[model samples]
Target: MAAPAPTAIRLHRQRRVLELTWADGRRHEFSCEYLRVFSPSAELRGHGLPEPMLVGGKRDVGIARIEPVGRYAVRLVFDDGHDSGLYSWDVFDELARDEARNWTRYLERLAEVDMSRDRDVVKLAALVGQYKPPQKPGG
Candidate 1:
């Protein structure tokens, strides 16, 4: 069966959610963070997945724009300058349908590696080898 086409798509900036209404009378709301972490771009999914890269520090990322892709998908431009993922209708539907499960898995993966959605945490981890703790004034 053919996938239902999107009848309407709206990005609510204040709420940071992508609201999609389909021809089949289904509506799905996707958070910007969710979309960013699950982007279909090669950078995120990797060329062949030896386990795609774990993305962190996207807690406040926002969709800068959503451009149509040949009536089949959308290219979401993120505020952080990522714009490679092409979210097709089918993929969008799958994301909406499997949101709960997928999000749980993502959290689990993050936990497994001690990573977080906080950018500061990622930066601190990257500086582990170079950062020096500040000395006390009288030490």
Candidate 2:
């Protein structure tokens, strides 16, 4: 019982989002930064390490190209010159399902390390969109 494949895929250049409409009529939109950070490439996956490397400074990353692979995956070429990951249908489904939780965890990890998502600057209080950092015990 394989997961159902996406019926349509659209890249919104202006928004920098990759949108996939699955066969079940569910649509998932992924930001370019999100996709890059979550890429399944061994490079990002850390070559079998217990945890993946924390990718920072991808707030403005964009997908340069998308190439189909056989019948199960697509290779995403990022503007930053990354094109190693082969994203499969299964991976896409899993990502879509866990997007919220995954994003929160990523942000938390960044906060833990005082990392920045900006390309060349590190801001201790730079937050994006509607992400409200967890409050400290006493501010």
Candidate 3:
């Protein structure tokens, strides 16, 4: 099968939904909360590890802004001042396709570890604090 070309992209700031339509007429919707938690960043996921840090208490995350990087990737500036990870088209497509399954697995893992993702800034700072990301190379 050929790769799908993006036909349209929409972001609903109020609803916190990012929608994408492909050339083949397939559409997908992803929530800002999910994107924030599952961000592909070292802060969220450590380097050289597939194990991810569970994120919770993001029942109300909002989309701040979406900036196009190039033809393939986009920089998502979240409302919570997280504007790091660069999401490419393929990565986004995978997230859209397997969102439900991945979320289910994440929840299950959290439950198995007897952990709660529900967290506020006050609570998180107590755990790990004042981390400013170093500049990305060639940026």
Candidate 4:
């Protein structure tokens, strides 16, 4: 069965959070940075790689607008001009369910590559000795 849509969608711009409340009395507050990084857009999700690309440097993003698409999804327009993702109810549910794990994983991935949540800030270690070139296929 498909996931149920949020009964109430509230954007707390001041706090930079997207809150969703469902019929089952479940509520989740997602950070704008979280939603932006985990966006269901092809630019992020459609990367043809086995895993989705890691997105960093969006710690302060806010939702500019939310446009409903039919009964199943909403398109999130970010203040940073990213408006490609269609966030379906299922997507929201999955995000809420896995928020903790996902956030941890995201942070770990960023650290692995010496990436930063702050824009344009690369770790000095990455610039010095931690930089490793991508491996060739099957090498």
Best by TM-score: 4
Instruction: Estimate, for each residue in 1-139, the C-alpha lDDT of model 2 and write its tens digit.
Output: 6677789989998899999997677998999999999999999897667656788899999999999998899999999999999999998988888889889998888877668788434464544543778999977
Rank the candidate models, highest TM-score first: 4, 1, 2, 3
| Each candidate structure's count of clashing pairs | 0, 0, 2, 0
- TM-score of model 2 relative to the true fold? 0.82
Model 1 spans with C-alpha error above 4 angstroms = 120-139
Q: By lDDT, highest first, what's the ranking? A: 4, 2, 1, 3
Instruction: Please provide, for model 1 over 1-139, each residue's C-alpha lDDT reduced to its tens digit, 9 standing for 90 to 100.
Output: 5466699999999888999997778888999999999998899898889655788778898999999998789999999999999999888977888889889988888876667888525445655867799999999
Q: Candidates' TM-scores? A: 0.82, 0.82, 0.75, 0.86
By TM-score, the better pick of 1 and 3 is 1
Say which prediction, candidate 2 or candidate 3, comes out ahead on TM-score.
2
Model 1 lDDT at residue 116: 84
The TM-score of candidate 3 is 0.75
Off by over 4 Å in 3: 1-5, 113-139
Residue pair clashes in candidate 1? none
**Poorest stretch of ten by lDDT in candidate 2:** 120-129
